[model samples]
Target: MRTSPRAHARVALAAGAGLTLALLVPGAAGAATGTPNVPTDLYNAYQPCATDPNAPLVVAGRGSGVTVEGIPRHTSPSAYYLTEQFRYWPVADPTQIATVERTWSTPGYEATADLPGLVDGSTYAWQARTVDPSNGAASDWTASCYVLADDTFPSQPPTVVSPNYPEDRSSQGGAPIHLELGSNGVSDIVGFQYSWNGVFSVSGADIGEHGIPHYNDPFDGPRSAVRADTLGGTASVDLMPPSPSWIQDLYVRSVDRAMNPSPTYHYRFRINVDAPKITKLSNAPYGKPATFKFTPDAGVQAASPVVSYTITRFGSDDPVVLPAEPSGVATTTLSLAPGETMTVSSLSANGWTSQRNWWRDETDTTTTVTSAQFPANTSSPAAPGSFHFAPKTETSQIASYTYAFGWSDAPTTVPAGKKGELDVTWTPPYSGWYYLVVHATTKDGVQLADTYYWFGVN
Candidate 1:
């Protein structure tokens, strides 16, 4: 439990913080039977950003609100304040931006007021008080809570420099790289947060218990934060990247004291020292499974035999792990579409992993439908044209061809000829560009990928 604001304020005053509070006697004119206690626990009411360093930087234009609550006195004769008042104003100018009053027969009610708009880079202060509308009596205002309205991101990204692994160049892997993070003209920047794989979580410094903004140890939290030197605004760290790639990037962001994050600075470099070699073992036609082998580098395999290969195929973000054979080589069969590629990384018996190696398969993607009478995009409106479709290969046995003039129309299907050839005729619909999609169903009941044909009806 937190200390009562009355007691805490007393203590703060005793400690010579120059704080003061007004006390009205019970007999004062039109005063309530018992005085309402000054409000306690004033903070940014936006729960998502209410915690710690985030509270101090209120996101302007997001309907951010402030909250303050009053705890009723528990004396024998309790006071029932009928109303609560909450208001916030610019810190520099005392003009009120907004104010809210709530009626509450019960005490200890929370008052929330929304800030529909605030000037960027400006600071605002808020306070709350309890009042008795019938008697026109009110408690002294609570200590003010301050928040900085910051709609702007940090000015710029962190200035990054690396000695061991310079930018855009290859360097030996399996060792830590020295990096120096410096400020980029953002005066309030306190540290740099970075990650090897561009995935990161955010956190900030804890605010003082009294809702006062204090910067005593802002660097204590944040899993990836590196505090800069207080005087020079620079810090150095040695970071080791796991699972190197042909082009590795250390994504870094500058974090201000208020926890505002800057744009990412991609610290790019290469670390392809001991990657596995990819070789095509067999060539199968498009849409058919083909075999490829992954072998570790000679020097790497001598020390630690390859155990498995991690392969990430194109069109998919997930990686698949394939165990290696007894000969320290791994092979996998994959059915890939034309122009698809995959990246492979090998793990060794000694728990070391090689860098990523890229491989591409040569799969033919020739269009099965061709037209001579209607060379693409040249036919006028109502012009009739004939299209011819043939099997992809002599071995491929297509049953029928299903095609549609455009996405909105119903598709028409025609049986293939004895020799697996298809012929169709259609009149142009309009003098504009149009597209036709065709899907071929193989005799084996497997549907191959769809082919798109684009042309214009002049």
Candidate 2:
């Protein structure tokens, strides 16, 4: 039988269609072949552009004109088409997804899309895939690529100020050196890096990968960059040195989230740690002036000349400023009661004060004689009249009183109540001048008070 071209074509078409269906089905084909090949080499070429170390980390507006490129694939060359899938979320989180899609014509390998509204400075992920228009089959999605959309740099450097002036000269022992850094014009200041060294410089490579400078040794090491909000409106640091020495220089710089660093600022100072010393001289007798000598410490001389010294009493805070003597030695006279204590400290020309030194007056002896009455200067040959007098009130606690005549007889007790008057029957020894003296003693055996009357017998 002769077959027509149309009938023969039908037979071929039916066989080819059956074979194609068999291949498209999962279990009946040599290879499951309807699905399009997965897209390859997907990438974001310019939409959310690559980060430029010199540019700001966060851009101001939404990212657009995001060009995504890929290799479109398909089982049948004529069916090749592309579907670019873009997904975005905060770099901080990826589970919550926002998506947009763009379709390409057959053989097309690239697509331009828009991230309509995205947060500034945020990073997002995107991907693309291919599809077979003939079988309605889609390829697996391409690998994801990340892009950041930031473009603003911190505009101003931090303003560093210190209430404690001459920070270098102020010793750590005196008070902690306090510093305040103002966030000037920067909208976001992440943290600060500071160093104390002998050298000062404005130019140096960024210490951290983020562009912050390292605070090298001699100073404490590099500090990790902290969040800007955590630092608030102003950042602060307290510095204290263990001993007295010259703090030659201090350097500081500020940084933002974009890794932008501010110009370095510097401060200079000389530390003074030395205070003055107070030395106690021999104890002064009661009623005599007690003397104390003040001397400057070695550190005082090393740091600066002692222009003047301030001496403060132990019980009082008021200071007495005195000119420094030719010798570093200064003496002050004080009269104190028995058992009373005195303390004094010295202040240097630079206003550095020394630790207070104390001195106690020696227990008082030799009582104060307020009044006395006895025979006249000249007495007849007979015995001198009886001694009489009103007793002086005890200024300090008194233990006992004694009466004596010209040092001839042993001291006799004048009972406490008898202080009003005393009868003297003893005759004066043959002497041109005789003295009748009364003495008072404290419980500690200190002679606290005494008085005497003199008489002459011709």
Candidate 3:
């Protein structure tokens, strides 16, 4: 016989009261049967509830939901038809439920409820109960299950703090770069997604298993993931590739539980292992300074501007520094000795030093005297023979030539066009032997070849 609504209501109220009484009097329900026929499934009739679901794992704004399973109240198969009542409330105030949802099935074993319009990053509690459809028999509410909603994306992009950040130029053997990141005050950051040569952007079609959308064009391969509750942290990465010519650009973005992404941060840099080239070393005369000219390596010039140059002379530890001018040429004056070895190296604005080029100074100032002539032997009071001086080569290098008769007397200067020769008539006062000498000097005042002649007087 079908039960009236009023009768059903009374039966449900009585059943609820009886379950409470059964708890208070443990053996009362079975005592009437003269045997302890206690209902083993009595707890199952109480309500359907989730077993230990972690809410923090749920994607907040992605319409994520949890499933609650029913417990049997009695051994009768008909009891499985009971209707399930599920309710959820914010943890802040459990007295009021934010939403109530109901579901019933032929077997009525479980219900997958939807939690719509939930605030991101909030804590909530949920509970469930069962009502018998035949007689309106209701069970007690189950224990509340607490969940943490983590749907909010990080507020700021991660800041890069290693490899000198924004701009860097280094040699191939430089130390691995330590990439540092920081949180934007959002503690719910689940992990980070990064691309080596690209930026991060939201994708409309690529959806994750949790119903959250993933970023588009993560890269040539899967995006790298770093899991952490707090995003702002650090990691060591090999910024330099195997070859110095391989440059790198990095982009990173933070991801929340809902897969929402933060703005992408970027870093750009290159490896310039090759040093600059010393193109020319201008020859300086004996007393003048030499100029060293250099050109940066092609890779270094493309990577960044050359800031300065260092010129080192062989046999000296000190170096001369020259600034890189607008012409892409760096020049420095060095007072170098003839045949001295000098090396030139280039420096980038970012502090990368190039290899050095070595060359020898070629300036020369030596005068070559081909021949000198005077009387080999002569008697005292004899007339002095003609004296002639000739240069074998580099006559332009001659500054002046001199002719001298003795050590005590000053020599006479020979004009350049005169072929370095002088004619003199001198009488030896009382000489056993009179000496004649010829000296030649370069234009720079460097003494060159000297010739000597002798005469006997009696």
The numbered model that scores best in TM-score is: 1
Give the whole-model CA lDDT for all candidates, comma-separated: 0.63, 0.50, 0.51
Per-residue error at 348 for model 3, in Å? 29
TM-score of 1: 0.45
How many Å off is the CA of 129 in candidate 3? 3.8
Error of 2 at 86 (Å): 11
lDDT of 1 by residue, 1-458 (tens): 12222332311111211112322212212233655566554545322223233345453333333333333221214454345565667877886446555444345433433454567777776666766654556777766666776656787888899987899998655446789998888877778888877875554223333333222233555446688886338889876666555678889887775456788899999875788888878766556688887887775577567888899988788999999887778888887665688888878776767788887754443437787756665654557888887766643566777889888879998877877678889887677777778876656554555777777776
Instruction: Write the candidate numbers in order of decreasing TM-score.
Output: 1, 3, 2
Point to the candidate with the largest lDDT.
1
Model 3, position 340, has a per-residue lDDT of 71
Clashes of each: 0, 15, 8
Question: Lowest summed lDDT over 10 consecutive residues: which window, candidate 2?
Answer: 10-19
* Alpha-carbon lDDT of model 3: 0.51
